[model samples]
Target: MKRKEYAWAYLFISAPIVGFLLFAFIPLSYSVYVSFTEYSGYQAPVFTGTNNYAKLALHDELFWKTLFNTFYSALSIPIGMVVALGIAMSLNQKVRGIRFFRTMFFLPTISSVIALTLLWKWIFNDSYGLLNYLLELIGIQGPAWLSSETWAMPAMIIQGVWAGLGINMVLYLAALQGVPKSFHEAAEIDGASGWQRFVKITIPCISPTTLYILITSTITALQDFPRFQIMTEGGPNYSTTTIVYYLFQNAFRYMSMGYASAMAWALGLLILAITLLNFWLSKRWVHYE
Candidate 1:
């Protein structure tokens, strides 16, 4: 009976294990091999050692530019987190119709990215855009957001923050809900002001959630692609072209599979390093019960 149970357990789990080996592990291994070779998608991969990485590091100006762009755009992560926390706090209120407000706040997260991008593209238009029109009403002239190099990345950041706000807000809302009301009551009884209680009691309890949001948001920001592909096409002097978008261009558009694979490995390593660093530093602040 014990042997039969173990066999059945393995059998039940084998499908996903096989799928992982076939789809994820195999492909990942192949990509590592490909990254060390010179190959277009159509050609046989030829061993090229570290040439792709060397070229990306020392020769490709666009690589550095896009890396910078990626980080710059990733600024939205913190900005969105802050804004989302506020929204989450607001939604956590016990007032009537709070559920409706929560749903409204979370709607954009579940909506189609393409549709949101298109809507933002229209909103960022210099001529007769809703954003510009509103600015104009205040006697201010809105710049050509998508067409201007200086403003394009900021525009992308704004849209990114808005688009991601709902999910982050939801996560924060859940975290806020998980916090014990008893702690707040204790702090209050000790003559702690609302702000003091929030600072001393609420923030520490939510630190783990904040760390979670930070790590995930950073990964998402670093891997951002679709928004730039749709909204900017990396235009206005490639100011909005992130690393992932560049990797996509090399792999699909330029047909440089090997180089793209190298980039993918590089990006993967970067993400790994950052994630490890987050975990390392989390010891200082992230609290769990």
Candidate 2:
């Protein structure tokens, strides 16, 4: 009877498992196979045996540039996560209309990416943008935000941080609420100052949430694509050309499918390496009790 029950339980999940194998696993396997071949999408994939990777390594300057851009975008992860945690903590306090503020903060996460990108594009516009207007009011000259190579990547980073902040804030809010009230009260009775209690108790209790935010935000920053394609198009001397954007251009624009496949594999390996490193380091600081 137990065996039959177990069989039925597995049968219920079989459809999704089969779908994963067919749609995701098989496609990934085929991409890996074709990375060694020389083929555009239209032609037969002839086995070239690592030539694609060799060319990408030896002569592809754009590949390295795109990788560096991705790294720069990822640099904001720590700062953004700290900001999100602060927002979450403030909202978790004893205050009225908490739901209203939470909704306001979270609505941006659901806004259309294209719309938000265009909105920020105008905000960062050199001529009549709000940013320039504010800077002028403060007696400071504003630089071109999206048009100049120096400001284009930073503009994208600002937008990326804004777009992602809400989701991470909500996650931290939930974690903050889950912490025991007894801990905070005990710290107060022990003559701990507000900052000391926060540093010792609040931060340690929230380490798991911090770890979660760090991993996901870093990955999102590294893999951002849409605005890079639509807004900058990797322009202003390739300042905003992220790895994924470059991969899209190679696969679709240049019709270098095999080389694109090689890039895709390399990107997956890099992300996997970073994620594994985060997991390994979590043991040192991420506390659960």
What lDDT does the true structure give each of the candidates?
0.94, 0.89
lDDT, candidate 2, 10-35, per-residue tens: 99999999999999999999999989
Q: Please, what's the RMSD in Å of model 1?
A: 1.3
Q: What does candidate 1's lDDT look like per residue over 185-278, in tens digits?
A: 9888889999998888888999999999999999999999999999989998888899999999999999999999999999999999999999
**Model 1 poorest ten-residue lDDT run:** 197-206
* Candidate 1 deviant stretches above 4 angstroms: 1-7
Q: Give candidate 2's whole-model lDDT.
A: 0.89
Q: What is the TM-score of each candidate against the true structure?
A: 0.96, 0.94
Error of 2 at 208 (Å): 1.0
Regions of model 2 farther than 4 Å from truth: 1-12
